[model samples]
Target: MELSEISKSEIEQEIQQSFEGLVEASKALDATRYFEFIDAERFVGLNADGTNWNSIVGLRELVEPGFNAVEKVESLIFTNVRISVIDLNTAILVNEYEQKILLKGGTHYKEAGGGTQVWSKASGKWLLVSISASSKP
Candidate 1:
Protein backbone atom coordinates (compact mmCIF):
# COMPACT_ATOMS: atom_id res chain seq x y z
CA MET A 1 0.00 0.00 0.00
CA GLU A 2 1.17 3.53 -0.67
CA LEU A 3 2.03 5.77 2.21
CA SER A 4 -0.28 8.56 1.06
CA GLU A 5 -3.28 6.26 1.16
CA ILE A 6 -2.80 4.95 4.70
CA SER A 7 -3.70 6.78 7.86
CA LYS A 8 -0.89 7.92 10.14
CA SER A 9 -2.71 6.81 13.27
CA GLU A 10 -3.20 3.35 11.91
CA ILE A 11 0.43 3.10 10.90
CA GLU A 12 1.54 4.17 14.35
CA GLN A 13 -0.61 1.51 15.97
CA GLU A 14 0.82 -1.17 13.71
CA ILE A 15 4.34 -0.15 14.55
CA GLN A 16 3.65 -0.22 18.26
CA GLN A 17 2.03 -3.62 18.14
CA SER A 18 4.80 -4.99 15.95
CA PHE A 19 7.41 -3.94 18.46
CA GLU A 20 5.47 -5.58 21.26
CA GLY A 21 5.43 -8.78 19.27
CA LEU A 22 9.17 -8.52 18.87
CA VAL A 23 9.65 -8.11 22.60
CA GLU A 24 7.54 -11.14 23.31
CA ALA A 25 9.40 -13.20 20.78
CA SER A 26 12.71 -12.18 22.26
CA LYS A 27 11.79 -12.96 25.85
CA ALA A 28 10.44 -16.33 24.82
CA LEU A 29 13.28 -17.14 22.39
CA ASP A 30 10.64 -18.19 19.94
CA ALA A 31 12.41 -17.82 16.61
CA THR A 32 9.32 -18.73 14.72
CA ARG A 33 7.36 -15.87 16.16
CA TYR A 34 10.36 -13.60 15.94
CA PHE A 35 10.65 -14.27 12.25
CA GLU A 36 6.99 -13.54 11.88
CA PHE A 37 7.74 -9.83 12.19
CA ILE A 38 10.52 -10.07 9.67
CA ASP A 39 10.43 -10.44 5.95
CA ALA A 40 12.50 -13.59 5.80
CA GLU A 41 13.03 -13.25 2.08
CA ARG A 42 14.27 -9.67 2.18
CA PHE A 43 15.20 -8.93 5.75
CA VAL A 44 18.51 -7.17 6.31
CA GLY A 45 20.26 -6.09 9.47
CA LEU A 46 23.15 -3.75 10.09
CA ASN A 47 25.15 -3.15 13.18
CA ALA A 48 26.88 0.08 14.05
CA ASP A 49 29.35 1.13 11.36
CA GLY A 50 27.26 -0.38 8.54
CA THR A 51 28.38 -3.96 8.81
CA ASN A 52 25.81 -6.31 7.42
CA TRP A 53 24.86 -9.64 9.00
CA ASN A 54 26.09 -11.13 5.66
CA SER A 55 22.86 -12.97 4.88
CA ILE A 56 19.20 -12.75 5.77
CA VAL A 57 19.03 -16.26 7.22
CA GLY A 58 22.16 -15.45 9.25
CA LEU A 59 19.95 -13.53 11.68
CA ARG A 60 18.71 -16.73 13.25
CA GLU A 61 22.22 -17.97 13.88
CA LEU A 62 23.41 -14.70 15.39
CA VAL A 63 20.37 -14.30 17.61
CA GLU A 64 20.46 -17.92 18.75
CA PRO A 65 23.75 -17.31 20.52
CA GLY A 66 22.40 -14.29 22.36
CA PHE A 67 19.27 -16.19 23.28
CA ASN A 68 21.38 -18.92 24.80
CA ALA A 69 23.47 -16.34 26.63
CA VAL A 70 20.41 -14.68 28.11
CA GLU A 71 18.80 -17.91 29.24
CA LYS A 72 19.95 -17.29 32.78
CA VAL A 73 18.58 -13.78 32.97
CA GLU A 74 15.95 -13.43 35.64
CA SER A 75 13.97 -10.86 33.76
CA LEU A 76 13.81 -8.65 30.69
CA ILE A 77 11.86 -5.46 30.50
CA PHE A 78 11.20 -3.03 27.66
CA THR A 79 10.34 0.56 28.50
CA ASN A 80 10.23 4.11 27.24
CA VAL A 81 9.15 3.20 23.77
CA ARG A 82 8.60 5.98 21.23
CA ILE A 83 7.42 5.15 17.77
CA SER A 84 7.17 7.44 14.76
CA VAL A 85 5.59 6.48 11.53
CA ILE A 86 7.51 8.00 8.65
CA ASP A 87 4.78 6.98 6.27
CA LEU A 88 2.15 4.35 5.79
CA ASN A 89 4.70 1.70 4.94
CA THR A 90 7.55 2.75 7.18
CA ALA A 91 8.27 3.59 10.80
CA ILE A 92 11.14 4.29 13.15
CA LEU A 93 10.84 2.96 16.68
CA VAL A 94 13.10 3.78 19.56
CA ASN A 95 13.07 2.14 22.94
CA GLU A 96 15.14 1.80 26.07
CA TYR A 97 15.21 -1.63 27.64
CA GLU A 98 16.92 -3.45 30.46
CA GLN A 99 17.55 -7.04 31.31
CA LYS A 100 18.52 -8.45 34.67
CA ILE A 101 20.78 -11.40 34.11
CA LEU A 102 21.64 -13.85 36.86
CA LEU A 103 24.62 -16.08 36.72
CA LYS A 104 26.22 -18.77 38.84
CA GLY A 105 27.45 -17.69 42.27
CA GLY A 106 24.65 -15.14 42.41
CA THR A 107 26.40 -12.77 40.10
CA HIS A 108 24.20 -10.37 38.22
CA TYR A 109 24.51 -7.97 35.33
CA LYS A 110 22.10 -5.36 34.07
CA GLU A 111 22.20 -4.69 30.36
CA ALA A 112 20.51 -1.79 28.69
CA GLY A 113 20.36 -0.40 25.18
CA GLY A 114 18.58 1.93 22.79
CA GLY A 115 17.26 0.15 19.76
CA THR A 116 15.98 1.30 16.36
CA GLN A 117 13.85 -0.74 14.08
CA VAL A 118 12.86 0.15 10.51
CA TRP A 119 9.62 -1.48 9.58
CA SER A 120 8.07 -1.93 6.17
CA LYS A 121 4.80 -3.34 4.95
CA ALA A 122 5.00 -6.57 3.00
CA SER A 123 2.45 -9.18 2.18
CA GLY A 124 -0.19 -7.18 4.07
CA LYS A 125 1.76 -7.13 7.35
CA TRP A 126 4.42 -5.01 8.93
CA LEU A 127 7.82 -6.64 8.79
CA LEU A 128 10.98 -5.37 10.37
CA VAL A 129 13.62 -5.15 7.68
CA SER A 130 16.39 -3.34 9.47
CA ILE A 131 17.42 -3.10 13.10
CA SER A 132 20.28 -1.41 14.87
CA ALA A 133 21.05 -0.96 18.53
CA SER A 134 23.63 0.69 20.75
CA SER A 135 24.47 0.09 24.37
CA LYS A 136 23.69 2.87 26.79
CA PRO A 137 27.01 4.47 27.59
Candidate 2:
Protein backbone atom coordinates (compact mmCIF):
# COMPACT_ATOMS: atom_id res chain seq x y z
CA MET A 1 0.00 0.00 0.00
CA GLU A 2 1.13 3.51 -0.78
CA LEU A 3 0.77 6.66 1.30
CA SER A 4 -1.44 8.38 -1.28
CA GLU A 5 -3.96 5.56 -1.28
CA ILE A 6 -4.84 5.67 2.40
CA SER A 7 -7.11 8.19 4.11
CA LYS A 8 -5.77 10.41 6.88
CA SER A 9 -8.52 9.40 9.29
CA GLU A 10 -7.96 5.76 8.53
CA ILE A 11 -4.29 6.12 9.33
CA GLU A 12 -5.13 7.84 12.59
CA GLN A 13 -7.51 5.12 13.62
CA GLU A 14 -5.17 2.33 12.65
CA ILE A 15 -2.31 3.87 14.59
CA GLN A 16 -4.42 4.20 17.70
CA GLN A 17 -5.76 0.69 17.38
CA SER A 18 -2.29 -0.70 16.86
CA PHE A 19 -1.05 0.71 20.15
CA GLU A 20 -4.17 -0.54 21.88
CA GLY A 21 -3.45 -3.91 20.41
CA LEU A 22 0.06 -3.72 21.80
CA VAL A 23 -1.27 -3.13 25.28
CA GLU A 24 -3.83 -5.89 24.91
CA ALA A 25 -1.36 -8.35 23.48
CA SER A 26 1.16 -7.56 26.15
CA LYS A 27 -1.30 -8.00 28.98
CA ALA A 28 -2.82 -11.12 27.49
CA LEU A 29 0.47 -12.58 26.24
CA ASP A 30 -1.01 -12.86 22.75
CA ALA A 31 2.13 -13.15 20.68
CA THR A 32 0.32 -14.20 17.53
CA ARG A 33 -1.93 -11.15 17.35
CA TYR A 34 0.93 -8.86 18.29
CA PHE A 35 3.05 -10.12 15.45
CA GLU A 36 0.19 -9.52 13.03
CA PHE A 37 0.53 -5.75 13.55
CA ILE A 38 4.21 -5.71 12.76
CA ASP A 39 5.63 -4.96 9.34
CA ALA A 40 8.05 -7.81 9.18
CA GLU A 41 9.70 -6.69 5.98
CA ARG A 42 11.11 -3.52 7.54
CA PHE A 43 10.76 -3.65 11.28
CA VAL A 44 13.04 -1.63 13.57
CA GLY A 45 12.57 -1.87 17.30
CA LEU A 46 14.66 0.35 19.54
CA ASN A 47 14.61 -0.15 23.26
CA ALA A 48 18.28 0.26 24.04
CA ASP A 49 19.95 0.40 20.68
CA GLY A 50 19.17 -0.32 17.05
CA THR A 51 17.76 -3.78 16.39
CA ASN A 52 16.21 -5.13 13.26
CA TRP A 53 13.78 -7.97 12.76
CA ASN A 54 13.06 -7.84 9.06
CA SER A 55 11.17 -11.12 8.86
CA ILE A 56 8.16 -12.54 10.65
CA VAL A 57 10.17 -15.54 11.73
CA GLY A 58 12.86 -13.30 13.16
CA LEU A 59 10.29 -11.27 15.08
CA ARG A 60 9.33 -14.35 17.04
CA GLU A 61 12.52 -13.95 19.02
CA LEU A 62 11.56 -10.45 20.14
CA VAL A 63 7.90 -11.27 20.78
CA GLU A 64 8.52 -14.36 22.86
CA PRO A 65 10.63 -12.67 25.50
CA GLY A 66 8.08 -9.90 25.99
CA PHE A 67 5.20 -12.36 26.13
CA ASN A 68 7.05 -14.37 28.70
CA ALA A 69 7.64 -11.33 30.90
CA VAL A 70 4.06 -10.12 30.75
CA GLU A 71 2.69 -13.60 31.27
CA LYS A 72 3.86 -13.44 34.84
CA VAL A 73 2.04 -10.17 35.37
CA GLU A 74 -1.49 -9.91 36.65
CA SER A 75 -2.68 -6.77 34.88
CA LEU A 76 -1.62 -3.98 32.56
CA ILE A 77 -3.06 -0.62 31.65
CA PHE A 78 -2.40 1.93 28.90
CA THR A 79 -3.65 5.44 29.48
CA ASN A 80 -3.39 8.96 28.08
CA VAL A 81 -3.26 7.76 24.54
CA ARG A 82 -2.41 10.40 21.92
CA ILE A 83 -1.99 9.71 18.22
CA SER A 84 -1.06 11.81 15.22
CA VAL A 85 -1.06 11.04 11.51
CA ILE A 86 2.11 12.19 9.78
CA ASP A 87 0.69 11.56 6.33
CA LEU A 88 -1.76 9.28 4.58
CA ASN A 89 -0.03 6.10 5.62
CA THR A 90 2.15 7.04 8.58
CA ALA A 91 1.48 8.03 12.20
CA ILE A 92 2.89 8.40 15.69
CA LEU A 93 1.24 7.26 18.92
CA VAL A 94 1.97 7.86 22.57
CA ASN A 95 0.52 6.84 25.91
CA GLU A 96 1.15 6.82 29.65
CA TYR A 97 1.08 3.22 30.79
CA GLU A 98 1.57 0.99 33.75
CA GLN A 99 1.79 -2.69 34.43
CA LYS A 100 0.93 -4.55 37.61
CA ILE A 101 3.18 -7.55 37.73
CA LEU A 102 2.49 -10.37 40.10
CA LEU A 103 5.48 -12.52 40.83
CA LYS A 104 6.03 -13.31 44.49
CA GLY A 105 3.40 -10.70 45.20
CA GLY A 106 2.85 -7.59 43.08
CA THR A 107 4.95 -4.71 41.77
CA HIS A 108 3.96 -1.54 39.95
CA TYR A 109 5.75 0.50 37.33
CA LYS A 110 4.22 3.82 36.44
CA GLU A 111 5.32 6.37 33.91
CA ALA A 112 3.79 9.73 33.12
CA GLY A 113 5.00 9.62 29.54
CA GLY A 114 4.94 7.06 26.76
CA GLY A 115 6.53 5.90 23.55
CA THR A 116 6.54 6.83 19.89
CA GLN A 117 5.48 4.23 17.35
CA VAL A 118 5.92 4.75 13.65
CA TRP A 119 3.46 2.95 11.42
CA SER A 120 3.20 2.40 7.72
CA LYS A 121 0.76 0.96 5.20
CA ALA A 122 1.48 -2.47 3.80
CA SER A 123 -0.65 -4.94 1.89
CA GLY A 124 -3.71 -2.67 2.29
CA LYS A 125 -3.29 -2.62 6.06
CA TRP A 126 -1.39 -0.54 8.61
CA LEU A 127 1.55 -2.15 10.34
CA LEU A 128 4.05 -0.85 12.86
CA VAL A 129 7.53 -0.30 11.43
CA SER A 130 9.39 1.23 14.33
CA ILE A 131 9.04 1.83 18.06
CA SER A 132 11.00 4.14 20.42
CA ALA A 133 10.06 4.44 24.06
CA SER A 134 11.21 6.82 26.82
CA SER A 135 10.77 7.01 30.53
CA LYS A 136 8.81 9.76 32.23
CA PRO A 137 10.72 12.91 33.15
Leading candidate by lDDT: 1
Give candidate 1 regions above 4 Å deviation. Answer: 1-6, 48-50, 103-107
Candidate 2: segments with Cα more than 4 A from true spot: 1-7, 48-62, 70-72, 104-113
Model 2 residue-pair collision total: 0
Question: How high is each candidate's TM-score?
Answer: 0.80, 0.71
lDDT of every predicted structure (CA atoms): 0.76, 0.67
What CA root-mean-square deviation does each model show from the true structure?
3.0, 4.2
Q: In model 1, what lDDT does residue 111 have?
A: 79
> Per-residue alpha-carbon lDDT of model 2 for 1-137, expressed as tens digits?
44544576666776777677777777678887787888877877655234544455555776687566542656566677777777766677766666556443344443344667777875567788877665655
